[model samples]
Target: MSSAFSLSSGRGRGAARLAAAALVWGLATAGTIAAAGTATADEIPQNQGGATATIGDLKTYGSAVIHENGEDSWVSAGLFEMSVENGGMLQTYGVDLHSPTQRDARYQETSWNGTSLSGNAKAGRIRWILENSYPQVNDLAALAGKAGVTGLTEQDAAAGTQVAIWRYSDGADVDAAAPQAQKLADYLEKNARDLAEPEVSLTLAPAAVSGRPGERLGPVTVHTNAGSVTVTPPTDIAAGGVRVVDQDGRAVTSATNGSRLFFDVPAEGADGSTSLTVQASTTVPVGRAFTSETHSQTQILAGSSESTVSAAASANWAAKGAITALAAQKNCAKGGVDITAANKGDAAFTFELMGDEHTVAAGVSETLTIPLQEDQVYDFTIGGADGGGKRFKGVLDCKTQGGASGIAAQTLSEPSPASVGGSDGGTDLAETGGSGLTPVIAGAAIALVLVGGAVVVLVGRKQTPPQV
Candidate 1:
């Protein structure tokens, strides 16, 4: 998403710029895990006492500009461009300014491009122009006194060309004074023919955010930090989706483009502070099982710093099981058999019993007394539709009361087939059976057969007695 904020000129501009620079540096440094080192200064070159040094008296005028160029995922280069008007001045005196240090400790030198020098400098480093005129120790001392600056010292007072140096343990001090120093440098460079400083412009790198991965099957939230800015909806936030609100719970206006969310916060508060709120949201498909995911990325806010935040969301769906019971009444006062069907799942179902169709809504139980002949079996079909448009079909074998009858209930523990007219394809059934007389009659028949076999064996033995 594209978001822009206005950086009001004046005092706020400097603070906003500095904050932005800090933000860029923080983002760049966050990826590098190394031992911190103390700042040390390199020895300055000394002028050897010799014959009157012949300093080139060439007049010079030029402009220096700085640009920000991103080089990789974790690094960006700040480039400086210098353009001089006179060719002779280029050979006489080169520009001297402190620049940012690169990831590599070696200082990068500017290459000549048709009388113009341009090269990459360290990101977020402040560069200051030093005096390059000869025999100006008295003038340098006076200027330092006027400016109330204490770091200035003349490096070579007797050389034909004067060189002044400012000893700094680190770039932090220079950065603190960069805004005011820039104004002075701009003015002097514009008017002074013998001295010049480059005009510097900084572009901060975009905030690198760690985005959630996998499929976020529902509403998901993503967050990151932008220096002093605090991100809400911490990592692994599951509910309420993603949203940005002020202290009063007032929603901040925002727009989302694809996976990126863009919003603006005031560059500075009424008290000259920086504060803003932002929220982002996206929808993902949920599956049958629970799915957990994380989102990470880098975001760049206009006129602000880059921040990286990661959030997690878990997508879950309920696994439903139908609670069903089949009740049968045999030899009722007036009916063949009473059948009842109950549904406890969150879905309505349709059932067919003894050629009668019935509808059973979710969490409801329906009972119907149907007349059927004794010892006769009938097809009792039940079907229903779930929330996902899937169909379920079940069948029960219903028989009227044969001998003795009472109420009986059967519980179903499995899901029905997902098609109409589909049999259970199993022998398990819930039904009332005939009386106990069937077993007794079968026993009597077995006894009669045994007696007949004994009588036949005795007659055969009597007929064969003479042969023995």
Candidate 2:
């Protein structure tokens, strides 16, 4: 009986040891756990900083060139080229030095979109206008000359050039690009300071925003691991201006004429900002000499596989969420976010904002605000869901909006295959593969298995019968 009991004990011990080893193995190697049914869900990819090839340096001034060499998203691809709109509300006083009818160097000026892309590259129609065209005949004539070299005669030894300035909506321009160059000559002749109220140019472009939604950029990804968010332009509207606020309706961040709203994880104990509004404006000069355009866009994050959204998804109330998503509206309906898993098991979800904690049901959407602090960080968690006999889960999406001229989130096509869980929520257990587990969970499992195996080997040798 003693021998039999020993045998039984040994077998039981071996089984327990083996189970421990397996668990350890699963934890030690996150990759293995991911492959096993112990872990599930897609690990958010790291930022590699790569973009498309056809893109070019979008900025026409300074060292602000769009270098999309290593960005790994669609924003980088579209940002290669920017939409530029130039308008000026200049007020000139104490100066009538140049003649409207005579060719004068004082009024002659030159300007450029700052790019040599050529007419073919532009592909669009060329427009020109004089916002306040009634100073003097000589000045007007000089302006005309600056726009284009229409005619030169023996009577006029020095013929002026007409200038062109691109206008959208309600105005027109003279020279397509160098209107100022030609106009400057005339202004100089008039001896005018031309103290213009800062010429207005709306250069609209989608920015490759980084970090998690509803949070500021940060370096803590463990319990604070949140996914990235993106701001995309609408197809029908352009983003002329951008601003951010907190939940209390206070201003947080403001972008000038040409800027974008980027996303990131905020630090802990961070007070979230509120709504984001994008001012979409087109400088429609007072005259109809030129055609105006309607600028709009749908915010889309390239390389980020999101779910389909319906009209209901448009409902997001979180101001901070709206800022990150760039939604035209400030709220999202219920269950707007969707989740799916590659398998089933332990999974970790990192949410960047407080409101993001709510799980995305079938068709609901939620929105929240992060206090306006560009330098703060925020993080949240999503609970795990039962694979329901399938695999995968988590908040696949969060929809929000910025005002007019702001970025927007992409809509999902259909219901996601997985369920979204929050860290604060109760876990729904359903065994499958480890693909759903967070990276940390998988790594821990593997380490445990390796340790167990070593212990089993050591104990087994000591129990072996004496050879001599």
**Candidate 1 error regions (>4 Å):** 1-323, 378-468
For model 2, give the 10-residue run with minimal summed lDDT. Answer: 94-103
Writing each residue's lDDT as its tens digit, candidate 1 over 83-188 gives 1111110111222121111111111111111011212122111122223221222475554444444443332111111011111111111111123233333332
lDDT for model 2 = 0.18
Q: Candidate 2 on 311-330: residue-level lDDT in tens? A: 00010111222112111111
Clashing pairs counted in every model: 22, 167
Give candidate 1's whole-model lDDT.
Answer: 0.21
